[model samples]
Target: MTRPRLSAVSVLTFSALIILTGCFGPPAPAPTSTSAAPTTTAAPTTSPAARPTGVTSAPAAPLSTAAAPPSSAPASPPPTEEPVPGGLPEQVAPLIIYYVAVEDNGVSGPLIGCGDSLVATTTAPVRFTDQVRPSIEALLANKSRGVGLSGLVNVLYQSNLSYAGGELTGSTITINLTGQFMLGGVCDIPRAKAQLEYTAMAAAGATSAQVFVNGRPIDEVLSLT
Candidate 1:
């Protein structure tokens, strides 16, 4: 039998057809998807309460009291006067007057012509000069005769005479003549006695003489006993 002769080209084409048939023989399987929903998880719950701090409360207020009132200043006192003895004007007057007389005249010798009968003597003559002695003698004579004159003379003499201690209030005068006696021997007893007599006489010459206590005058405060 006469078969068709195959050319080189036909042989190549046949080999190619065999390779394509084998390559396209089978296909791979397709993938599949399911229609399902996604799931969500819930968070933990916390309490809504507030916490306390270190210092919880505040301090309480203090109590109150009433205040005191202010005070006023005090008043000043009045000036004071010197003190004089009271009562028994008669006794004090005579004593004070007599002492004043003795001191003013500088009496040294014994008292004479004073109490009763008015006669006195001394160891020596009066010491004061003639002019001064007579005046002093006059004072003594006047005192022996009257109380008013005696008081006045005492005041006057005391003013002129030097003394240690003395004070005068109203008509009343207190005199300390004891120290005067110490001055004796400087003048003779006669002269001293004469001076004493004269001073007493002068005190007796006053008309307005009075004894007082507490700034008030008293009657008969002085009298010869």
Candidate 2:
């Protein structure tokens, strides 16, 4: 017996069904069984402790072993001497006093010429730097007990005159006096001037002298008196 031939449509339908079954086979091998990418967990993060406000840390300093130098202080000044009370004693030496000389037997005598009447005599020790003043004082004291040595006849002896002071400038010496000046006689004026001037000159070792009595010059007082 002879077999029958299949139609083209029936053959195509059977081929299509066989291809669909091969595409959908075994549920696609169960989707390959992936393990969900292994869930990654980060370690616990810890922060440092907070610091106090306005506080900062500083670096440590290095130490040294060298010694420091010594310093110099200022020196003090010396002490000065203090002045003493009542002053010191004056240096003294013998000084001369001038007087009018007269010719006499014992004590009292007649008037000698005024030009040649001066008699140099010794008195007690007086200050060296202040000889003129003390010499005048000695002359006025009229203590000369020597024979023919008389100053009592002078107007200064009777007038109660006192020595103010004296000054020696260059070769000239000046003698000052303050008191009531009276003239016992007209001749006494020259006698007084001579006595004072000569006495001051000898004491001061001066060549000349100017005598002022009561602020009036010797020459002026003599002219007026």
Candidate 3:
């Protein structure tokens, strides 16, 4: 029955308080960091309306509206004159052209004498400041139809006649003529009224010329038989 033991300095002070609680035991919880804190994974943020999956971009150019085309008006200079060395310029001249003389050697009958069967020829020159429209366009261009083989005979040659123009006023030169003024016989109505009134009065040196055919009155279209 003798139970009172424990005292080797209280069992060495309870064995140094159990060796200071196993050498400060609460600090053992710090080593439980299972290696996870270094995982910062936040660098993947790119969100500015995010567009870069397989990369496709390229569709912008489209602004034109249309409306620009109006600049065109600069052209006026043309009138200087002064330079004439070779030919054609001293105010040109020459352009007579008349015909109908066949007085026998090649007689085809009937024109007894419309001012003794006309004559004269000349042509090719023009511009004495415009000689009465080029001498009635060289008597309607019958350029002396071979001067009727030298005897003369432009009874308004081929007579499909045209020249519908002339005026000359002061000395009176009307001419005008259009077409269909025929008369191949019956002395071609006074040799076509004396070859268009002596070729419009020697081409408007006019002492009077009144032709008109088509407006009637080259003596009523040559009905003077």
Best by lDDT: 2
- Model 2 TM-score, 2 decimals: 0.51
* Clashing residue pairs, backbone N/CA/C < 3 A, model 3: none
* Full ranking by lDDT: 2, 3, 1
Cα lDDT for residue 148, model 1? Answer: 46
TM-score per candidate, chains pooled: 0.16, 0.51, 0.28
User: Between the candidate structures 2 and 3, which one is better when assessed by lDDT?
Assistant: 2
Each candidate's clash count: 26, 0, 0
Name the lDDT of candidate 2.
0.67
Q: Which 10 successive residues of model 1 have the least lDDT summed?
A: 216-225
lDDT values, one for every candidate: 0.34, 0.67, 0.65
lDDT (Cα, tens digit) per residue for candidate 2, span 1-225? 899999999999999989988988755454446746554443333522343444343445867777766557665668878957563346787777555553332233223444335555675666655677678887777633342434434446556678998777999998888876566666666667777887788877899999887888878866876
Task: List model 1 lDDT by residue over 177-200, tens digit each.
Answer: 221222223222333333443333
Residues 88-159 of candidate 3: C-alpha lDDT, one tens digit per residue: 344776777666765542244324454344666776656665465666666666634457457667766666
The window of 10 residues in a row where model 3 has the poorest summed lDDT is: 39-48
Scored by lDDT, model 1 comes in at: 0.34
